[model samples]
Each structure stands twice: as structure tokens, then as C-alpha cells.
Target: LKFVCFNNDGIDEHMVWLIGLKNIFARQLPNMPKEYIVRLVMDRTHKSVMIVRHNHVVGGITYRPYLSQKFGEIAFCAITADEQVKGYGTRLMNHLKQHARDVDGLTHFLTYADNNAVGYFIKQGFTKEIYLDKDRWQGYIKDYDGGILMECKMDPKLPYTD
Candidate 1:
């Protein structure tokens, strides 16, 4: 698998990648232009973005700054349908966690994902925080069976790398 990394600067390409991610993240189209997202991804203070591969575009992640300032939330992460369960998802998670820790100096990471992904995050060292009803979800809740929140402390002692 190819691990491609890019930010919002590449508007068209990023939007195309986001479209493919819709299903996995259960997010609705915002109607905002790609430039808006590019701005967020380009923001030096509050956010970051990473695309998994240039060709496959198998997965990508968006992280937003958290209350702690040094930490961030895994706002959105997705692996294409066909690429699921082939280790791309796990690799993507590892990459983002490392990025948040090593590159950004963030110690905590969080996510709210469908049940299908809860175990995956758990396996990656995240601990479940709570389970939220489908109604509480803001986007694409109807598309998923259920939702769960998880968090983990990013420490160098962990085997994962940036």
C-alpha cells in the first residue's frame, strides 16, 4: 500500500478524496468549496490533514485542535470500502496518531466512529470513552449502526511511529 501525504493546498484533489471518504465517515456534503477545507488544512494553529495514497486514496484523516491546545481530535478518518480490513485503516490510524504526537507535539487523540471501527481503534491503543445515541451524531448518523468515542495518550514508549 502507498502512504501518500498531502494537505488542503491541493484543492481539487483533496475534494475528490473527501468524496470517496463520505461513506466511511458518515458525513454529508457541506456544499462548501474545496478552498474552505484547504484553508482549514493549511491552518497553522488549529488543524491538520493527511491523505493515505496518491493513487489509491485508500484513506485520509482530519484532526482539529482540542481543548487542551496541544492535543487534537480525529475529526474525520476514512478508508475506501474496498480497502477496508486490508490493514490500510490501521496503518492510517497509526500514521495520524504518530503525526499528532511526533510532528505536532500532541499527546492526546480522540475519535467518534461507528461500531465497526470501535474495535479497530481499541486495538490501536484507544480506550472507549462513551457511546452516543445515533440522534446525537451531527452527520451521516443514519448511515451507521452506532457510534462510540475513544481516546488515547500518545507516548513514545508505544511502538507506533510518526
Candidate 2:
């Protein structure tokens, strides 16, 4: 699968891609309202890193980077149920982290993982012991009702894709 990242550079130009990404995320998150997924995917501040194969979007992570804050918040992360366990999730996340670091100048990632996702985030190097100063991300991100906050500090030396 090829990794593709999209932002709201020119909404009109990338509408088709954004739509497909939205649909894939929606399917993966059947419990989440489709409208909510649409809002996040289309938000101007958010960027989506997707895994596409045979010209079809298979998985993606939608995140919003707070550049001045030196971090990015993961809004949505998922792989098609059929595509899980094949390592696409890892590749997708590595691409997102690299893109955030190189293009957005972000050095950390924060995510609110519900019970079901906590283990996955842990495997991706996220820790509940948030090292980021509370003052930086406290009021910036929306609090999720039943989600546990996790943080991942980007390592500058490692090539994540490897």
C-alpha cells in the first residue's frame, strides 16, 4: 500500500480523496456517527495519512497538529477490518509521524484512546504517563468522556518506516 497524506490545500481539488478517506474511516468506526467522521475529515486544521492500494483507500489516521505547541492530536485512526493484522496500521502510523515531523515540525503526538484502543496505542509507543507539560495541551484538545489520554514522543533519530 502507498501512503498518501492530504490536507485542505484546495478543498475542491482533493474532495474526491477526502470523501474516500471519510468513507473508510466511517466503515471502520461503525459506532461513530458518520457526520462526526465527516466533520473531522473535512476540518481544515486536520491532516489525514492514508494507505491506499489498487487506487482504493484501505486505512488512515486523521490528526490535527498544533505546530506552535510542538504536538499533534490523533483524531481518528483505523484500518479496514479486512486489512487488519497485515502491518498496514504500523506503516500508516509511521508515515503519519514522519509527515508530522518533517512537514509540520511536530515532535509529539497525543491521542485519547478508548478502552478498546488503549492496547493498540501502547504497542505504537504511546504511554499514559504524559510527559508533555499540561499547560501546552490541556485546553487545546477536546476531552473524550471515556477515553484515556496517551502520548508518544517522536524520536528524531529513528527512521520509523523501517
lDDT (0 to 1) per candidate: 0.58, 0.87
Best by TM-score: 2
Against the true structure, whose lDDT is highest? 2
TM-score of each: 0.63, 0.93
**Candidate 1's residue-wise lDDT over 35-146, tens digit each?**
5545444554434344445543556776765434555666566666666678776777777776667666777765666566677788888888633333333342223224
Which residue pairs does candidate 1 place in steric collision? Answer: 4-52
lDDT of 2 at 29: 74
- For all candidates, what are the clash counts? 1, 0
- Model 1: residues >4 Å from true position, as ranges? 10-54, 129-146, 157-159
Estimate the overall C-alpha local distance difference test score of candidate 1: 0.58
- Clashes in predicted model 1: 1
- 1-162: candidate 2 lDDT, tens digit per residue: 578888866766367777888888788777778999999898999999988788787889999999899899999899888889888888888898889998899899999887798988898999999999999999999988778999999998688875
For residue 135, model 1's alpha carbon misses the true position, in angstroms, by: 26
